[model samples]
Target: MDSQTGTHDDNMKPATKKSLRGFAAMDPQRQREIASLGGRAAHQSGHAHEFTSEEARAAGKKRHARAQATGESPRA
Candidate 1:
């Protein structure tokens, strides 16, 4: 059960604009370990989406637009 929502935990709710919990709260080594597991799973499952040059450009544009709209400078 999710304490915040008081319901069975699922990802229906969007993440908060800011978070200091879960993997974000974990130490760097722990975060890397978790991220590595995710990458490995994606490879094993053959469901990872790879961006081509054009797709990457479009995705970058979308990300930058969101950041600018939020008054945030995009991180490198």
Candidate 2:
């Protein structure tokens, strides 16, 4: 992060930044497109997990139970 501006540093040299960029500088649509492509590639490469229907349902039920018990968002 930039100290004076209190913002992420986006003015990095090309050599330093060739592999990554300040995500805040990316347009939302472009970010989504890139993220979607990465997700598809991960699944194609067998590197990403896909939940079974039963697993998803169980997870959702657990989340709801947690929320009910805590009175806060399950995600929190």
Candidate 3:
């Protein structure tokens, strides 16, 4: 039974539930270590995106337009 909702899911086994919650139950340091490994692998595999100046300028313009429409100030 779920403690928060007082209900149970019959389809999921205990091990499955534990595995699903495994990553989030890890410490902050361990989480960052795993994330860093993935980032390094992505860069090494030539899948990381490096934005050009024109692309960055377009993105900034879009953000500024959205902020102006919403009456929120854009960041520098």
Top candidate (lDDT): 3
RMSD from true fold, candidate 1: 12.8
lDDT of each residue in 1-76, candidate 1, tens digit only: 6889888757576657876897678999999998999999998999888889999899889999999999898774
Tens digits of lDDT, candidate 2, 1-58: 6779877767764455555568767999989999999999999999999899999999
Cα error, candidate 3, residue 40 (Å): 0.6
Candidate 3 lDDT tens digits, 1-76: 7889988879766664445377888898999999999999999999989899999999999999999999898884
Error of 3 at 11 (Å): 30
lDDT of 1: 0.86
Candidate 1 vs candidate 2: the lDDT winner is 2
Model 1 clash pairs?
A: none
- Looking at candidate 2, what is the lDDT of residue 48? 99
Question: Looking at candidate 2, what is the lDDT of residue 75?
Answer: 78
> For each candidate, what is the lDDT?
0.86, 0.87, 0.88
How many residue pairs collide in each prediction? 0, 0, 0
- Using TM-score, rank the candidates from best to worst: 2, 3, 1
- After superposition on all C-alphas, the RMSD of every candidate to the true structure, in Å, is 12.8, 9.5, 7.7
